[model samples]
Target: MTPSAIPGPIDPPARLLMGPGPISAYPSVLRAMSAPLVGQYDPYMTQLMGETQELYRGVWATSNDATLLVDGTSRAGIEAAIVSLVRPGDRVLVPVFGRFGHLLAEIAERAMAEVHTIETAWGQVFAPSAIEEAIVRVKPTLLALVQGDTSTTMNQPLDEIGAICERHGVLFYSDATASLGGNDFEADAWGLDAATAGLQKCLGGPSGSSPITLSERAVEVIRSRGRIEAGIREDGDASAADFVRSNYFDLGMILDYWGPRRLNHHTEATSMLYAARECARVLLLEGRDAVIERHRVSGAAMLAGVEGLGLTVFGDVAHKMNNVVAVEIPAGVPGDAARAALLEDFGIEIGTSFGPLHGRVWRIGTMGYNAREDAVLTTLAALEQVLRRFGASVPAGGGVDAAADVYRGAA
Candidate 1:
């Protein structure tokens, strides 16, 4: 296809993104991404990286000096943490509750760890005792888990799990990609050795960069594996590992780039870093508690609205995630068709479930900048219209009314 044969500049239909992540980016974040690029070693660029690290520290609620951006998407952050932390033959325990749990196991396995999992039914979270039992049985060097699983719209309770890992002398790691900024997360207080998140979800930015934080324990593990290959170190210095294995994904080198010495690694993705910095800056200026409360209220409104539409929610309602909700697909209605209609006709986007729940549930998200009153109400109203068009018996205006009532009660 020749360039001239292709379509001309077209405006994307403005969408109300109520899907599972890559949520609508804030205007400031988008603007930041459009800023001019600079050479990687430019002093101003280096200062930008330092500022990004500090901003992420505030978002993550951590004082860990090793915090920085991983050059890929959120999963890159996940892989970097696992591959760097779990050495060959190390034991790692993962509590499987959704698709992302399996992801942690797969990454650990690739890292050559002896991976053990304590799995609960999909849409369910592990009890504190259950996790404690797993830790006792496995005696793992690390415990990896996800704070929120968008596939099931479930938020696993983390505070207790952290304590359990701590008691078992295990290092706890979490993927807070879908939960941070919109929900409660404490790195130091929760005893997390490492936690990685993405800018795309609750941070209101694009997916090119990942924000990661490492505790002292996590840092020690990385440092132990650091080695100056043949000519890289001083003569007679103790030899480290033959090589760090994965070069691009190595957090040790990434840390040095963020550290005072500012060693070389991959050329940082300047635009994405700017976007990440602005996202965190927006969150910090908004106040963490205030942002969390906004998500809570907006999510509550979405849940109430869906229930008022006479649709049953898919997960344990009490343990649902603050940024996303899973609603059962109405009988006789094609799930994909409903989602397409919502997008094409209403200019709204919602997600479907993954794995075993595929085609059985719709995942509606209230995340990042979209977690607002107007977004919630508009989504509910559009959903009602779509469902009614499909002959689903939804009470007219009931969903929006219920959502309004929820907001009023909260106010």
Candidate 2:
């Protein structure tokens, strides 16, 4: 390849991301990413890091001092928390309801923990009694769960599960990547030992950084397994015999880097840090409850719109998340083709489901910056066109009108 063949600076076409995340980032978040770079230890950079931790405390509704940003995607946070908390051969219980639930079980297996799973149907969430019964049988050292799984648009109830784990003396962790910021999550009140989330969902930013918080108990476990790397080791520093296996995901070392110790780990991903900081700042400015309410309204509108178009909604509608809804594909409509047509002709994007729901349902999202009146109405209107074009019967102006009624009711 010739040097001249190099592509021009990235100039991608714009489209509304109405699928399950990596959704449209807030405009302010994009502007934050472009801020001039600063040294990792620059006073301003350190200040921003500390401030981000505090802001996330409000976001998580927790007083945990161990809260901070992980230098990778949302999955990175999940791995960091699990691997650091669960030692080799430790038992871990996971309750699977959808794709992400399986992801938690898989990560636990990779950590070499003896993983146990109890699953309900794809569209169903477990009752508190069911989780408690599993806890009694497994007696696991950790209970790993996903608060929201986009695959089925289902939100597992975490509020009661935490107390169940506490009674059984098990560490409770939740992957809130698809739920936090857009839903009600009380890390402290829910008795979560650890929780992690990504920015691309309801946080209104790109996917590079993850926000994570750890309870004091969770922090104690991670620190007990601490191992400072050789070159960075100082006179009195110590390492545990069963230290966390993955250096990159060792929460203890990461903590030293974020803590007042000012220790060096990896050179910070400065721009992503800026983006993370701004996402929290913006959410706090808008008021956390207010942002969640916006998501509730948008999700309800999307659900009504699809139903109004004569589409069937999937899952236990009573327990669906406030940000995404799964609409069953009509018998005659080609799901992928309709989605592609919507992308090409309307310049919008929605998602197809995975696993059992694959080819059976389309997952539509109203989240982050795209959770608005105009975005909901436009997507429904465009989708009506796409469905009709694909030879599916849809009510004329039905989707828009139903969605509008929802907004009016919300107002």
Candidate 2, poorest ten consecutive residues by summed lDDT: 232-241
lDDT of 1 by residue, 1-411 (tens): 998899988777788889988789999999988999999989899889889888888888889988889999999999999988888788999999999999999999988889999899987998889888888988999999999989898999888777888777899999999999998999888888999999888888889888999998889888778555434753345544323558888888888878998888778888888899899999999999899999999999999999999999997988898899999999998999999999999999999888899999999999999999999999999999999888899988999999999899988
Stretches > 4 Å off in candidate 2: 1-3, 226-228, 231-241
Q: Estimate each model's TM-score.
A: 0.96, 0.97
How far residue 204's Cα lies from its native spot in candidate 1, in Å, is 0.9
What is the alpha-carbon lDDT of model 1 when measured against the actual structure?
A: 0.90
Backbone clash pairs for candidate 1 read none
- In order, candidate lDDTs are 0.90, 0.94
lDDT string, candidate 2, 1-411, tens digits:
788998889988989999998899999999999999999999999999999999999999999999999999999999999999999889999999999999999999999899999999999999999989999998999999999999999999888988899899999999999999999999999999999999999998999999999999999898776475784544245543366778888899899999999799889999999999999999999999999999999999999999999999999999999999999999989999999999999999999989999999999999999999999999999999999888998899999999999999989
